[model samples]
Target: MTTGTPPPTAPKRSRARTFVPLAIAAWAVLEIWLLTLVADVAGGFTVLLLLLGGIVLGAVVTKAAGRRAFRNLTETLQQMPGRPGATAAPAAPAGGSKGNGFLMLAGLLLIIPGMISDVAGLLLLVPPVRAVLGRYTQRSLDRRMRSAAPGSFSDVFQQARMHRPDGKVVQGEVIRETDPQQGPSRNENPRPPLTP
Candidate 1:
C-alpha cells in the first residue's frame, strides 16, 4: 500500500483559455467607453489625429526596438566563450528579447486606436516598466523551458537529466570476433556428416 499523498487533479476548465477571451472582451468595452468620453471633450477630429499620430509612433518604436534587440543578441553571442556554432549557455540575461516583445506588444496596443490602449502602451514604453516586465518574462520562459519534454528544443541546451522511476531495462550480451571469415567451431555446433 502507498502512503504518499494523492496527485493533484486538473481543473475542469482551462483558466488561460477562458480568461483570454474574457479579458479581450473587457478591454474592448472599456476602450469604446473611453473613446466616447474623449470624443465628447476633445472633438472627433482631434481624436482621429491622435490615433493617426499614435499609429506612426508605434511603427517607429517597433522598428527601433526590433533593431536594438537584434544588435544586443548579436553582441551577446559574440561575447560567449565557445567555438562558432557551439551552443554555449546564455552568458547574459535575455532582457533584449523580452524588451523587444513588450515593445512590440505596446506598439500593437497603440495601433488599436483606443485611448485606453494608447495609455497602456505608453506606460509599457517606460524604461522602469520595461525592465520589470523583462525580468518577469525571463523567469516565465525559464520555468517553461524547465518543464518542457525531453527531445524538445529546450532539452538541447539543458545539461540536467530527467528522472523516470518506471523506465524499462533491457538485458543482452554482445559477442565480438576479430576474424570475419572464421566459422563457429564444431564443439559449438556440430555439422551433419557428408553423404557416402
Candidate 2:
C-alpha cells in the first residue's frame, strides 16, 4: 500500500534565480573601465570599431548556430513515438515536447552573452541530453500509472455519492422508506392492516 513519488519539479535553471547578475554587473564595470583606458591610450575610433565588430560577429554566429540546432531538434521531435510517423526516428536525436523546450531554451541561453551559459546551452542542444530528459519523463509517467488506484464499475456504483481516493471502498447507503399511499399515513391508524 505504498503511494508513488510525485514527479520532479522543473529545474530552476533560470538566470534570475542566481547571483549571476552580480558577476555580469562586475564584468560590465570591468568592460567600461577597459573602454576608458583604451579611449585614453588609443584612438576612440578603434575602440568603437572593435565593439561594433564584436556585436556583429556574436549576432551572426548565434543566428546561424541556433537555426541549425533548432532544426535538428524539431526533426527529432516530429519523429518521436505517438507522433505521426512515416519513417522511424533516428536513435541519435531523442524526442519529446519537454526535450525540445529544454533544447530551445538552452540555445537561447547560449545566445545570451556568457561563455558558461553557451556551454550549458550546447549540452542541452546535444542528442544525449535530450535522451536523458526523455527517459526520466517516461519513467515518471510509468511510476504514476503503476501506482494509480485500480477499480471496476461495481466499485463505482457502490460508492456513487462518496469520494473514494483509493478507489477500493464500498461505502454508501440506500434508505427504504415505504410510500405514503402503500403504507398508512401518519394521520391514519397504526393498528393492523385496517380490516374494513
Candidate 3:
C-alpha cells in the first residue's frame, strides 16, 4: 500500500561531524612533517628563533588589527542614525570591518606556529583576497537571513487560521447604507442586527 520511492538508508555515523576532527589530524601531521624537514635543513636553534620571531610579530599585528577593527566598528555605529535602544539600523557596508577582522584572524593563524597557517595568514593580508572573502561572507549572511522565518509569530498564526479546515467561523450581517440624495453606496458594515 506504500507509494513513491523508498526512503534512503541512514548512515550509522555522520560524516559532517567527523570531518573537522579528521582535517585537524591531517593538518597536525603535515605541520609536524614540515617542521621536521625544516629542522633538518636549518638547525634547531634557528628554528626556535624563527618561531619566537613569528610569535612576536603575530602579537604586534594582532594588537594593531584588533584596535583598527574596533575603531572601524565604532565609527560605523556612530555614523548610523537613530537613538540607542530604538530599531536597529541596517548594518554598515562590509569592507572595513570585514577586512580588519580577516587581518586579525591572519595574525592569530601566524601565531599558531605552523607553515600552512602562516601562508594562509599572509594570503589573507592581501587586500584583494580580503575583499573577495568579505563579499562572500556578506552574501552568505544575507542568504541565511533571507532563508529564516519571514514574519512575526502573529503573522504565522493568522496565516494558519486562514488555511485550517476547522478554523473559527465568524457569523455576521453586512449592511449596505445609501444616501437619500445620492446613488446606492457599496460600503459594507459587518455587525449584529439591531433588536426592537
lDDT of 2 by residue, 38-108 (tens): 77888788767755554454456456656766777788777666677735645565333345556556656
Ten residues in sequence with the least summed lDDT for candidate 2: 89-98
- Candidate 1 lDDT for residue 183: 70
TM-score of 2: 0.37
* Candidate lDDT values, in order: 0.79, 0.63, 0.77
**Best candidate per lDDT, number?**
1
Q: Tell how far residue 26 is off in model 3, in angstroms.
A: 0.9
Per-residue lDDT of 80-174 in model 1, one digit per residue for the tens? 65658645675655545556888988888888889888988899999899899888888999999989998898886553334434443445544
Task: Give the runs in model 1 whose Cα sits over 4 Å from its true position.
Answer: 1-12, 76-98, 140-196
Off by over 4 Å in 3: 1-13, 77-96, 148-196
Model 2 lDDT on a 0 to 1 scale: 0.63
Give lDDT tens digits, candidate 3, residues 1-196. Answer: 8699988989778787889899999999998888888889997877788777777777887998988778876767676556564336565566555577788888898898877887888788788998999899999977766566758554575677778857755566566677769766556444579554
Question: Candidates' TM-scores?
Answer: 0.59, 0.37, 0.59
How many backbone overlaps does candidate 2 show?
0
